[model samples]
Each structure stands twice: as C-alpha cells, then as structure tokens.
Target: MMTVDYRTLFADVHRRPGSYGLDGSYGQAVAFIMGCDAGNAWGLLVGFPEWLAMKAGGGANLVWSALVLRIAFPGPTVVTAAETLDQQHDEHAVGALFGLLDEFLADRKGSRGAAAIVSSYLDWQRLRREQNS
Candidate 1:
C-alpha cells in the first residue's frame, strides 16, 4: 500500500478552499473535516470487533463488514463546497485548526487513510450547506 502524508493532504485542502466552500480559510475547514473523520473512524474501529465476531460463522461477516466499511468511507475523502464565502474575524483559530488537521493527516496510509481525509471534507461540506440553508 502507498503511504499518505496528511500534512501534505492538509496543505492541499488548505490550498483548495474553494472546493469545500467559497471561503478562503482552509485551516478552519480542514480542522472541521479532520474532526469529522476522526469521529467516523472511531465509530468504525469500535464496531470492528462485533463485526468480526458475527462473521466468524462463515467469513460472511468479514465480507459484510468490508462492504459496509467501504460505503461508510470513500476515496479522496476531501471536502467539497457547493457555494462561495467571505473572510473570518479570527485567523488564529483557523491556523490552529489547520495545524491539527495537518498532524492527523500526516500518519495515515492506504484507502482508509484516504477515506478519512475525504470523509472529513464531505462532513464539512454538509455542514456548510445546512448552515447556509
């Protein structure tokens, strides 16, 4: 499996603020996405044991778990924005969020790692839409 550098991923996300939302602040968005990804990943990992136990019968559990996980998590897991935005009042918070996301994305690998990144982005996008609506 290929290695993924989350710092780079965060930087990419930061650079592409237009993708997640119209705002130019990639840091805050990245932070939000990272938090969402962490939450989603935690849920998946926590459920793994139960999924494994249930599949011990004919290994069908494993297959089901894999399928569910795949759907729960998708590739290029980055955020996408369906609208535009303006500047924020606090740059410090944005910087801090960017830093946090950078750290989280730095240590991941393979599809799951990619999924985490993408998942976070989508979560942010969803929030942005709801807030605007």
Candidate 2:
C-alpha cells in the first residue's frame, strides 16, 4: 500500500468537484461535497447509523471526519496543523477524525489497517483534487 499526504488530498478536494459527482461551478461543487462528507462524519460521530455514516462507524471514521471537517472549514476551525505535533490536542474536528482512526487501529490491535485506511483516503483525496483541479 502507498502512503497518503493529507495536505495534497486537501488541495485536490479543494480543487475538484465534478469528479466527485457534484454539480454547479467548481468551487460550489467542491464546497458542497466537502460539507456533505463533513456532515456525514459528524453525524456518525454523534451516533448516526453506520450506513448513514459513510465510513463513520468503524475505526477509520475519526480520520474520515477530520478530513471532511478540514475541507469544509479550513484555517482554524480547530487546531491548525501548525499548532500541534500530537494530533490528539489540535481541535475537536481533527481529534474526531484521528480518533476514529486510532479506535479502528486499537480495535484491530495494530496499525496495519490504519495505514491502509489512510492510504485509501489519500488516494481518494488526490483523485478528487486532480479531477477538479
């Protein structure tokens, strides 16, 4: 599996809208999709159904949610990346996202699955960004 650079993912997601099945102008579409994903993650964390959660129920939900929130509201909705080395204390959104990843890894008893999940997210983020960009 390959590693994912989240910064690149954000740039992609920020740039692409059509590739994600969104309509409207590029910015509008990307923003809409970003909000939808973020809302779904938020919903999952708050006890929404697994199906509705969109990868929110499992251990990876935390990471998924963090990325969603980051896309939806960038630049200090929580602790900006510059603020903390340890992801746990950055911001609520970031914590929720990584929290899911952590939980998933812990439940599985290792970082193997966590790495895959991260990789997949990175790939998806990159693809979306490229399509839109």
Candidate 3:
C-alpha cells in the first residue's frame, strides 16, 4: 500500500510557492483557504470546519488534504460522513473537499470527498435557514 507522511509532506509544501502564486507551505495554503492558523495542521484532520473551508482543485489538493489526516478511510465511507454532516449543516462551496486523513483524519478519494463535503454544506445551509427562521 502507498502511505503518505503528512507532517513531512506539509513541511515540504509549506516551504514552496504555489503555481498560482500562493505564498507559503501546505499549512499556509490550508490556513489561507480556511482562514484559521494552520499551526501544526494535525487539528485540521480532526475538525470538519476546516475541511468545510476549502474545495478540491485536483489530485494535488487531495494529496495535501488527505495526507494531513492522522488516519485515512476508504473513499466511500468518508463521502458518507460528509453526507451525514449535511443532515446537520450546509457547506456547499467546498463540496469538492470531502476527500481526505490520518487515523486522526479521513482518507477519501478526491471526487467522493467533494460529494460528501457538498452534502454536508447543503445540510449546513438548511440548518442556517432553520436557525434564521
């Protein structure tokens, strides 16, 4: 099986610049995308809010997002979790980001992850509306 070491990879990514002129490392990009301090980045794997902040652009995006996880589940299960999150909340913008983790994070494929995230976002939107009502 192919395994990714998140901390190491994050360290490397954070050290370089993005092709689109994103300055800083993987952590920086995540922090920028999330509007929170990337810090060590391990917390992101555990928190759904951070995941809600970003979308999947491609495999490169998934590599960084999933590798940060302390754990990784199969693509389908992670997508399911995102859908379940939707039942309680809505975060459609980043719907494409559910693909993720370490044992602390979920390992989802990019496409499925995006579906799960979109579902969660839809739920989030519903919750928001309910709250406003």
Candidate 4:
C-alpha cells in the first residue's frame, strides 16, 4: 500500500503543471486533485470539501473545487453555471487555485482550530448519515 502526502503532491503540481498534464489549466488541475481524492485509500483530505465550503461560506451543495473557484473569482466572474465552466480553464483561476490550495494545506498543517474544523465537518457527516439511515 502507498500513502500520499497531498501537501507535497500539490506543491509539485503547482510547480510543474505540465508534468502532470495539467498544462496550467485550472479545470485539469481540479480534475487531477479530485481524482487523487477519489482514489485516496488512507482517508487523506477527508472533510476537506466541508472545510472549504465552510470557509467559502457555501453549503455542501457545491463541491470543493467549485468552492475554490468561487472564492478565487467571485460575483459576475462565475455568475452562471455556464460561465463557471468557462472560467475553470482560465489562467488566473489556475493561479488562484494553487494559491488557495497552499493556504488550505497550511491550515491543515498547524493552524489554530484546524482540528476543530475537521471535527465539526466529521460531526456534520455523522449527522447526515444518521438522518439518512
């Protein structure tokens, strides 16, 4: 079994997007991260989406990538779903994505209340699961 140090991986991706086939495309970067999360067996990045949504003042309706994109380019920049998709590949958005991701990882590293946020997100997930069951 292999473990992923997502913070280091994100840094690598940010440093050389071309090596990852991202080509400096925000959409592709988002896709790559999402794929990594999906395949993560060690539970790394757990509660990240919830944390991001909370940070972005968004609900769970939008995914983590959408939350990042929204935070990076708010208002009319992503007013509609169509426009949101269009901006996903924007160069500016790509820069913002990596910057925000760095912030996110730093928060995870040692920021005050980082555990509280993840704990709160876990509680939310537990409540949702209980409600559904």
Candidate 5:
C-alpha cells in the first residue's frame, strides 16, 4: 500500500490563507501538527465526525460542515482527504488531537514500522482479541 503523510498534507492545506475557519495560535498549531506523526509522518485524515466530537462544540466547524453537506466527494479517499483539508483548528482541539493520534499511530506502527516488509501476526492476534473482547 502507498503511504501518505497526513501531517505534510494538512500543513499544505493550512498554507492557503483565508481558506479556513481555524481558531488558535497559527504558529503553535503548525508546531504541534509538524511534530505529530500519523504512523509514517505528521498528519492524517481521521473521520470528520471523530474530529468534531473530539474538538468542535456547537458550530466550530460549521463552514466545512456546510460544504461537506452540500458537496459530493469523488470517493472515500477524496472524502477523507477533503476532511483533512477542510479541518479547522481549535487550540484545545489540536492538543487533544495529538494525544489521540499518538496512541493510534503507535499501535499501527509497532514493530512493522521498525522494518519495512515486516509483519507481526502475533501482534495482530493480540489486537484482534482486544477488539473482540
């Protein structure tokens, strides 16, 4: 599978001025996002609802939500990518985002990340059991 660095992808999205409704310290958000790794690197395209529940309260992401509601994305990948790009920032939200991403990426990258082409069925089995129980 092809790998994508969500951090790079989102940072680029942030680069465009007047394109977001983010509410936070720009430098700090950039710093935080740059430091995070979505498995292989910083940035990821997590579900929009997940982001909203984690961060947005009330209408924090109303603009993007409006857009998403009105538009039809090309596919699942496009929808996910759009969600990442359309993401708005909240200082509190971004911090929480990192904590969650770290936990998630660690599980995804454990062992396999150490060596390319590596597989860990034992680890997978443990995870499967955890998921089921």
Candidate 6:
C-alpha cells in the first residue's frame, strides 16, 4: 500500500484545483476529497467533522463540508438545497473550504502532533455528550 500525504495534496489542490479537473467549485472539490478519503483504507477523515464542528461552532449534526459552507456563507438565507449547492460553487466558498482545510492540516502538524489535536477533539466530544446527557 502506498502512503498518501493529504496535507500536501490539499495544498496543491487549493493552489490549482483546475489541474485536478475540479472546475473551481466547492462541491466538486469536496467530492474529489471524498473520493480520496474513500480510497484510503485508514479512513483519514474519521474525526475531521468533529474538528470542523469545533472550529465553526457547529454541532454533531453537521458534516465537515457543511461546516465549511457555513463558514464561507455565514449569513442565513432562505434557499432550497439546489440553490445552496449552486451558490456554493462560487469561488468564495471554495476558497474558504481550502483555506480552512489548510488551517486544520497545520494544527495537525503543530508541536504536540496530531494526537494532541485528537485528544482535544475527544475532550470536546465528551463535553458535548455530558451536556446532552
């Protein structure tokens, strides 16, 4: 099995998503990332949604992609799912997704390492569970 470095790949994708046939759309970029995660046997995105939720002030119900969308388009607007999807294809939302992803990756590479981040996420999850209980 070949090891894939997703951090570098994400940075490259952010730099030139068109090179990866992404059409500069957040939806397409997310789909591409989903494909990559699906191919990785290790489930690289296992706790990413929780991490994103922590960052974006979202709850467990929202996935990482939704968190990205919320961060990009913070204003609440009444729109159908299709309308929202269309709107998310804009450059602003795509930029936010990749930019946030870069930040997330950087945190994972911080001094304490990915394990520390995971520990923080676990602590957050415990707190949320306690609050719900």
Most accurate candidate by TM-score: 6
What is candidate 2's lDDT per residue for 1-133, written digit by digit as tens? 6654433443454446346564323234335534644755643222222211335322234433344344324453442232332333333434344344335434334443434545555665566569888
Task: Report the lDDT tens digits of candidate 3 across residue range 26-131.
Answer: 3335555453225435444433443433332112224344423322223433332222333222232122232232221342344436447556656665675698
Q: Residue 32 error for model 6, in Å?
A: 0.6
Q: How close is candidate 4 to the true structure, as a TM-score?
A: 0.68
Where is model 5 poorest over a 10-residue stretch in terms of lDDT? 51-60
Q: What is the lDDT of residue 100 in candidate 2?
A: 45
Off by over 4 Å in 5: 7-90, 112-133
Model 5 quality (TM-score): 0.25
Predicted structure 2: lDDT = 0.40
- Which ten contiguous residues of candidate 2 have the minimum total lDDT? 44-53
- The total of clashing pairs for model 3 equals 35
- TM-score preference between candidates 1 and 2, better one: 1
What is the number of residue pairs that collide in model 1? Answer: 9
User: After superposition on all CA atoms, what RMSD does each candidate show versus the true structure?
Assistant: 16.1, 16.3, 15.6, 5.5, 12.7, 3.2
* Candidate 2 global TM-score: 0.24
Q: Is candidate 2 or candidate 3 better by lDDT?
A: 2
Which residue runs of candidate 3 sit more than 4 Å off their true CA positions?
1-11, 16-50, 53-112
lDDT, candidate 2, residue 120? 58
Give candidate 2's error at residue 63 in angstroms.
12
Best by lDDT: 6
Model 6 alpha-carbon miss at residue 41, Å: 1.8
lDDT of 1 at 59: 28
Residue 107 CA displacement from its true place in model 4, Å: 1.8
**Candidate 4 — which residues are off by over 4 angstroms?**
1-4, 76-89, 111-115, 120-133
lDDT of 4 by residue, 34-111 (tens): 788678662555666777776665556776777777776677555212245554447666677777777776677665
